[model samples]
Target: MAKETKAQRETVERVMREWKDGALETSRGAPVTSQQQAVAIALHEAGQSRDETPAKNRKNLRTTKAREAKASETREVLYAEATKRGIPGRSRMTKQELVRALQPR
Candidate 1:
């Protein structure tokens, strides 16, 4: 097997450090899925420069934020509907619970 060059060794080390440090977390404050981590690792291995990484990460963050906002809005609507119908425990319910409780019996 051919020996790895210095640059390839450096790239591997960087990717490993990022993974160990949990630096690839998703925008929603969750750990990135293994699939995402693999993509990022592949990109880094391809010698993609660091200057481009932030922009791609930022775009992902914006999309995650939008999705979270939509989910929050849906939860709020469910809460409002439950309150209007005098459903008890609405305030205590999680978003999923609120959705279920607000559904037509």
Candidate 2:
């Protein structure tokens, strides 16, 4: 029930149809790849009207913000640790790769 732009609505509808057509997978239900899909499905299950704003959408937005903040903090810490350790290419490495590289052998 979030106020979606036309493009967003089309994207959600396409995803749902593809899911039904067996053209998509949840990729083992990984949160990153499936988050939007989950939201769409949840709205559908809750009988969310396109014109009515959903309370759960607001709650979910808060949750998403919290997750993003945590991830940003983690990236900052990882960058600092990598810099301290003098890890080559640390600046270019992604968060997950930095974490793997910094893990104890």
Candidate 3:
């Protein structure tokens, strides 16, 4: 299981949501339209950039998986969990969108 700190997960969710709404912008004030670019920007802003070496990335993943309460699971795992949890519109959600819908307030 991966453990995303609440703040980290929220950062990703907020950024992606803004991207979907055509509200996310780049450093140059251009609207962010690419999903991949949005994710990269989200992670980078969260200080978990994928630009790092593979080993470091793997280490980060492992650490997240081994974390305690409310641990974040793998995409497949989380997807299945979401299905069972009856998350609305889950059938249309990409793996990265899980955090936003979980136990939504």
Using all chains and alpha carbons, the TM-scores for the candidates as numbered come to 0.31, 0.32, 0.46
lDDT string for model 3 (1-105, tens) is: 346677667667877888999998896779998999999977765446657765665555444333322245666776787889988888788765765456334
Candidate 2 residue-wise lDDT, 8-74, digit = tens:
4554565566565655445354333455765565344333535335666554444434433445557
Whole-model lDDT values for every prediction: 0.58, 0.57, 0.67
Off by over 4 Å in 1: 1-73
For residues 40-83, could you state the per-residue lDDT of candidate 1 as single tens digits? 65344534425456567445444434433445667778788788
* Candidate 1, backbone clash total: 0
Error of 2 at 51 (Å): 58
lDDT of 3: 0.67
Q: Residue 71 of model 1: what lDDT? A: 51
**Weakest lDDT window of 10 consecutive positions for candidate 3:** 62-71
Indicate the residue-level lDDT of 41 in model 1: 56
Pairs with steric clashes in candidate 1? none
Q: In model 3, where do residues sit more than 4 Å from their true spots? A: 52-105
Superposed Cα deviation of residue 39, candidate 3 (Å): 0.6
Model 2 lDDT at residue 19: 62
